[model samples]
Target: MDNAKLQQHAIAAECFVEVPFFDLDPMHIVWHGNYVKYFEQARCELLRKIQYDYPQMKASGYYWPIVDMRLKYIKPAKFGDKLLCVATFKEFENRLKIDYVIQSASSGEKLCKGYTVQVAVTTTDFEMQLVSPPILGQQLHQFIQAQ
Candidate 1:
């Protein structure tokens, strides 16, 4: 989705990260794989804001695992460059779908944009759930009501 469409979701979170030297590749820019880490950081912030992070998910007898992920890199993030990562809920009833954007902290230039899709799975039986569990609905409801 486009940026305007991404803004339509009320459930979202943002976090800032400074690219670490260790994440640099031989070319001296961030490795392609590191973007996923940045996305996860922002995603965790979103889940925490909704009070349904990993611990809560497990406690609710469900495990939400990423089944799909896609990323588009527009620019290279160098070491020490600060980036703003945003994560927003795209769809959450049937599965957890989140959209992400990574931009330069100072310039606001988008460095990368991506999305992740996760589906609920039963922790006890290890069965993939066709629909999200009730706890997710409850948490999402609470988030929307609070906003």
Candidate 2:
């Protein structure tokens, strides 16, 4: 399936955030990098709901760090603006991928969309994973089945 279609497999999380002063730049707009944190927040929430959060990942003897990230800005978000952030699981196998969408809460204007890719590494030898651990695959399968 294409990326658009894979969105169906997504486990989503939504959050409301007020753009902080520190997140803004000299032009008084939220910096691009801060969006990555927003995506992380939403994605972690989704993972936790399935009992597979970061701590569980470490306990499972694997480390999954973001290896790829992409973002498209559609509009600017200003400091103090309340916005909604949505993140969805996009893929899980050799890696975990998530897609994100950000929008202005009051105007409902689309602000940005992005995706992040994280690959698992064996904690013992630091070897990269060729396929996802059963723990993740099984949880994803169960989530899909329930949906």
Models, CA RMSD each: 3.4, 2.5
Cα RMSD for predicted model 2:
2.5
Off by over 4 Å in 2: 1-9, 145-147
- Residue 90 alpha-carbon offset, candidate 2, angstroms: 1.2
As a whole number from 0 to 100, the lDDT of residue 122 in candidate 2 is 88
Q: How does candidate 2 fare on TM-score? A: 0.89
**lDDT tens readout by residue for model 2, 1-147:** 333544666578788889999999888999988988888877888888667889999999999988999999998899899989988887876678888899998988999999999999989998998888888877666666777
**Best model number under TM-score:** 1
lDDT of 1 by residue, 1-147 (tens): 332433465677999999999999999999999999999999999999989999999999899999999999999999999999999888776788999999999999999999999999999998999977878777777766677
Worst 10 residues of 2 by lDDT: 1-10
* Native-referenced Cα lDDT, model 1: 0.90
Candidate 1, pairs of clashing residues:
none
What's the residue-level lDDT of 115 in candidate 2? Answer: 90
